[model samples]
Target: MIKPFSVIATRLVERTIRINQAARTFYACEKGSIFINFGVIVVPLIAVVGLGVDVGRGYVVKARLSQALDASALAAAPYADNVVKLQAEFTKYFDANFPSSFMGVDITLAPPVISDNGTKVTVSASAILDTTLMSVLGEDTMSVSASSEVTRLITPLDVVVSIDTTGSMGSSDGSGTRLSSAKDAADILVNKLFGNETESDNLQVGLVPWSAAVNVAERGVSYDSGLNTFVDGHWYTNNSPVPFITEPDSDWQGCAYARYTDNSNDDDADHLLYDADVGGTIWEAWEPMPRRVVNPSNGNLYTVRCPEWGISKLSGTKSHATDAIEELSNPTGTTTIAQGLVWAWRTLMPGEPYNQASIKSNLRRAIVIMTDGLNTSSYRDAYKGDLNVSEMNDRLSAVAAQIKATGVDIYVVEYHVETNLMKSVASATTAPYYFKADSAAELEKAFEKIGTELSELRLSK
Candidate 1:
């Protein structure tokens, strides 16, 4: 214990060196542990950030794919019956919505799936997105997929087709008489609407062959005093006899003039003429005048003839409508578009003379008025042929407004001529509701389009 000073000093120095070596070894161990911990934490953190970015990109691609799939499904749903057409439509809409190099991702679209006897359509697509950050985790790419479904459901629908049977329709429209072309076009529409079935539970169609006046009598459309209603007579004048005609009420044909109380008051006159209320004004029976009226256009004397074919009330049987349309021959009368439109509107009403329409709240009513000329005649009363062209057209427009207000879509198909009134009436329903067909083929195509639209294509999923 009692060693020399040099020995004590050497021991102290050795002890100090040993303590410094221990401290250095401890510091090196801590530094090595920190470096190992940083390596472990940073690698995972980078991977997690990359996963987030890649997953976010995957979600974006999936959203876009969903949108494109939906569009494709809806576009192809209408053509479910034809495999060729459905495929064509699906590819067209998908290409329009999603490009080949969308978001730098590779895309593949599957064929459209049609089921439920062609009533349902399903569209699916997928995208292969190359992963940037996720590659470190052994995921080189991510697959995102989406699908959409559409269903073709036929809703309760009532359609009234009012065709002009004016004399001008007898003229040739290149291939055949305008009347013949119109008949062919109408047949196409009915065929499309009915499809393979002769009758449908949810579909009802009515035909209104109109000229200077409607022939309601031929259909036995008359007012019923016992029921206090006009049975089968849509909006017919209530308990009114023929005016200005010396013939007895029994001799009155089923033809009726437009109702009017006071022509001097424009508002009141229009209200009386266009309003469907049965109690407002009385409709007078049209009787052939003893003297023929002078034809202004040809300076020849001609008697007015009611359209031979009467209004065909809404019926589920396709043959009933076709039969009425087939009888649309001998076009020989002045144009009275207002009368035709009003009669068609009455056919769609649930409570009127033709109460064939359903009282359901979801019923869809539409009026397709196909005319070849302008209004050349007025109501069959005092101003029968006295009103000028402007007055007649104004009346037609007023009636159109009233019809559209009742939530009935009005489609105007102008054949061979276009008019401002036709455009305005069609626009009242919506765009593309107005179709101008210059030829027979165009007319057929227009009706086909309308029938397809009315079939009611919707997305079920």
Candidate 2:
């Protein structure tokens, strides 16, 4: 019994010592773990938050770069002609729009050359931005670029200044009488075409005075009815033959071919034909042609008659048809739009004496056919019985088609076309044609908008 009790007591003491050692080890381990947890978790959380702040700053800078690039592109478009000016403008724009705080922003423009020759304008620009947070990820900076090539807006413009010269033109619109306002608009266009006396050479202007009938400039000719005998009324000469105005036929004996002629040796043959009709009492056949020279003294009018053919034709002179515009005050007769359209086509035709150069080739060719009233039957007595609106529309549409086929753009404007019969007629033509204005102000705004769209500078050398 004594041996057993001694053994028991010794075991109890060993257990107590072992328990105390374990308690001390637990306390030491808890202290060490607290330090390690603070370093590994809390420190990394702070570093991650710092990186997020830097990343956010980088994004903000990148967004600014994008906006600045767009603003700079727009500022550069207008100055595309002057490279130095474009660069200067870009710098100004970039500075104003993209002021960077983190790092300096740089912009570059390529091919700063602008040609005056009719061509397209194109511009390329790039921007570089520096980042703070991303740099910590081994990325020090970021770059962005943008490019925009705006083909200078070329508006197809055709305007028939059908001034309401009727005595009412004496009334005022904005500044003065309707006539005065019309003149102001015309002068604006004139100034635009010719900056000074020298630049005027590149542009052509023709006047149409309409009262009973729209009479064109002395140089203007109408290609509507009588000429339709040639090519079934299609004025674009390439079509099949219908009629030639200066033919020895009985219809044109009283008139002469006043169109322009090159100094071709063969023009003398054309003169022979004209002379036979004017001077000769009989018709003659076409033969091998000889070239003729234009009389410089006659403002470049070619009047050489058939010397060999013994035909004494009258000299070529400007048309006697006065401008019908002066009589706008006495708009007594009915409106025949066919006549107006024909005249418009002639005014834009090339190779014609009145049309000095091709308005189509050099400048944009556009026609604005506007009318308050519908087709009439009074003036053209020949078609009195055949009062077909459909027929009239077909004629107008045919002419429009021919003109458009030749690359001339057309726009038809109507004051009250919705309830009118001619609305469908204008609608069937090539491009956009419509009208829905209730007030005069709307009308004027529409006109101005059309003008702006059509007058956009078409870049050409």
Candidate 3:
């Protein structure tokens, strides 16, 4: 067994060589496995990072799409009546808001949906974003969508249109008579407010066709304990005798003079020209007296020939307003803006000679006064027929302030007349409350714009 040492040593060397070769082979295999594992991890890591980036891009695209959709819906809301026009408006606004190929995204807009009897508008859109590194997972693109809706509802509104039927309106404004033009403009406004309904529970309109005086018609008269007479819900006494009157109180016509304490003394007078209350102050019947001019044809010197068209109280019936407007003919008398405006204010109030209005806090009241001339008459000169321009303007301003304080918006439309008085009365410093029209066409456009604004469009979604 202990034979030759050389043979044993050779065998041991051979064994050692084999062991070293095996170790080398194992090392090479371990290095190859590490490379394979690194390669396998790199693809999934890249996919995860790309997923975050692409998802973030999709979110951005979705936000932009939602905003554009909202804007488009609102823009198209007003044109809900016509499908073609509504779609045109929606596309116009959406394109303006969101550009094509924005954020490397492909956008597709769906057609607008109009419902609820043309009161609701709905818009939707979809976007696709191409994937960059996520293509390894077979997802070449990401999808996002957005939608928006808008609804327009009309609010409760009460409007009184005070048209100037003075003699100056009988003249021409390069088209037709100013009075005719006013009628046409007023008709347009009424049509807009009424829309398809002949009568509405939330809408009421009144007409006050005024000139030098208003024809209040015949109203009941009662006597108080102090011999004071309550005529047409206004208190009056013998002390303030009907101005320059020779006829008895029973024969009194429909016209009434402005309220004042005394008709004789202008210095010691307390003017109630702007008061709308029924029980407090004294009033006087409007009697032209001996100043009446005789008609050459009839040989009759009518004592009181006020405006033929009288005041029409607030009513929801469209025909009532249109009928009153149609009767706006044969305009004759000087301009008395204060009288027209005060009467309009009274019509809007809940308690007055005209009690057609309700006392709701949410009601929106407005006065549209269209005039073609300046103030030529005043309460102080109602009997004398004197031209008190300054006093008339002051009274108009005071009445306008009082009306505005009661949350009633006053819109002044001066047709064929240029004056700062109307602008000031309308408080035009902040809004487009005052409009000046030199022609009949311009006047119609102005009234149309006002009517559209008064219609009150809003987003309800």
Candidate 4:
């Protein structure tokens, strides 16, 4: 007979095994549900990451667009704010600024629009950045745009046009003869300034034609009463006057001699220019030039002439400027570029000795020196070419700095010739205003361009 307790124990063991199997099945089903939920979450996560990458690219493109637009607007602000004229410049600068290639990017530029009576210029541009990862969101590209504006202002300006009329200018080239071409260019510049039908009370122009010497045309001057005059390699003073030329008082003829510049102390008032008596460096002792005047009364006697073209003071009238340019003549003498520069500066000074230019308010004062050769002149009274070629360049560089220090800018135009020394002279004031011309037309173009630059072209915005 089987015991009842044994059968009950067997039944208990079987029930425990079945309960454990059911628990494992429930766990397996719960694990499958968790994996399915993860699959759904992964889709949005990928989209979020793609959105971030594509949006970042879009922002970069937009930033670049803004920079290009701003640059274009500033460049075009100088014109009449005419969109047609500005289009080329706008595209050119924008291409230069945004010079890199973007992946799947397309750029479009809208024409500039003028407002505020042709004083304000506005530029609009747009770019489309194609999506890389976020393209799955039914969006192919993101559109971005930039707009910029600038106001054109009229900056008050003054300019001095100085010419080198040395014998070398007699050389002929493809631009016609140098002197003739220079005259044409100067006339063109004057017409561009005062004859453009634009009211120009704010504009004034001066002409200085220089050679071995400069003539101020009968002006009062102050000079150093100390140094003696050197004649034909002989040094003497008025106390022992050597009667070779006319007296300084009677036949002085309102001409200025070069100023003595002591390189050791050129900053001294004695070295200062626009004064006459500072050792008579301007004129070369009134010597006989190669040209002879056969007056019957004088009986073939030699006559003296200053080694320079007469100066025309700063004037606003077109006739005044034209007449001045027409009077430029071929003279036989060596080159004295420093004297030319000094006298040009004199024409722009405020008081004493050629007091033509004055500044009560802000103005753009500039000097344009056009030369075809190297500087071959020096402070004859004191230095007298003691400074070699290299040394002379140093002296000119110092003088140019002095002029620039007094709020004047210097521009150099090298025609039919180019040299490192001339470039240095121009760069002493500001960069890239130095122009080189190999032909006659090119020379004229250079002057016209400089004239345009000296005019008022202010970016107001």
- Preferred candidate (lDDT higher): 3 or 4: 3
Q: For residues 1-461, could you state the per-residue lDDT of candidate 3 as single tens digits?
A: 22122332343355446545654655566554766655655665566666556666666788888989888887676556557867898999998999985887777889987774555677898877777666775667767888898865667899999999988999976667989999999998887677556777888999988887665531123312255455654544343322322232543334556543332322112223333333563343333322354545657654544676667888999998988898789988888887788778877777545678866668999999999998885322333344467866777787787788778898889998878888877856323478888888999878877776777766555
lDDT of 4 by residue, 236-305 (tens): 3333222223334433322344433432424322223333232435422332122233445545644333
Best by lDDT: 1
Please give the range of 10 consecutive residues that has the lowest summed lDDT in model 4. 283-292
User: Which segments of candidate 1 are over 4 A away from where they belong?
Assistant: 1-47, 81-83, 104-106, 114-119, 152-155, 167-198, 217-308, 318-332, 377-386, 427-430, 437-456
lDDT of 1 by residue, 318-427 (tens): 99888888878989778878878877877777753556887767889999889999877543422355567787677777778777777889888899998777888774
What stretches of model 3 exceed 4 Å from their correct place? 1-65, 68-145, 153-155, 167-181, 217-255, 260-281, 284-305, 326-332, 377-384, 416-418, 437-445
Q: Ten consecutive residues with minimal summed lDDT in candidate 2?
A: 309-318
Give the clash total for candidate 1: 2
TM-score of 1: 0.69
Q: lDDT tens digits, residues 194-302, model 2?
A: 2222322233444443322333223223223333332332222211121233333222111222222223212222312233342323223221111233444454533
Clashes of each: 2, 31, 0, 10
Could you give the candidate ranking by lDDT, starting with the highest? 1, 3, 4, 2
**What TM-score would each prediction reach against the true structure?**
0.69, 0.43, 0.67, 0.61
Could you list the CA RMSD of all candidates, in the order they appear? Answer: 14.8, 20.5, 16.1, 17.1
| Residue pairs in candidate 1 whose N, alpha carbon or C atoms collide under 3 angstroms | 217-254, 237-283
Q: Pick the candidate with the highest TM-score.
A: 1
Model 3, poorest ten-residue lDDT window?
262-271
User: Which is the better candidate, 1 or 4, if ranked by TM-score?
Assistant: 1
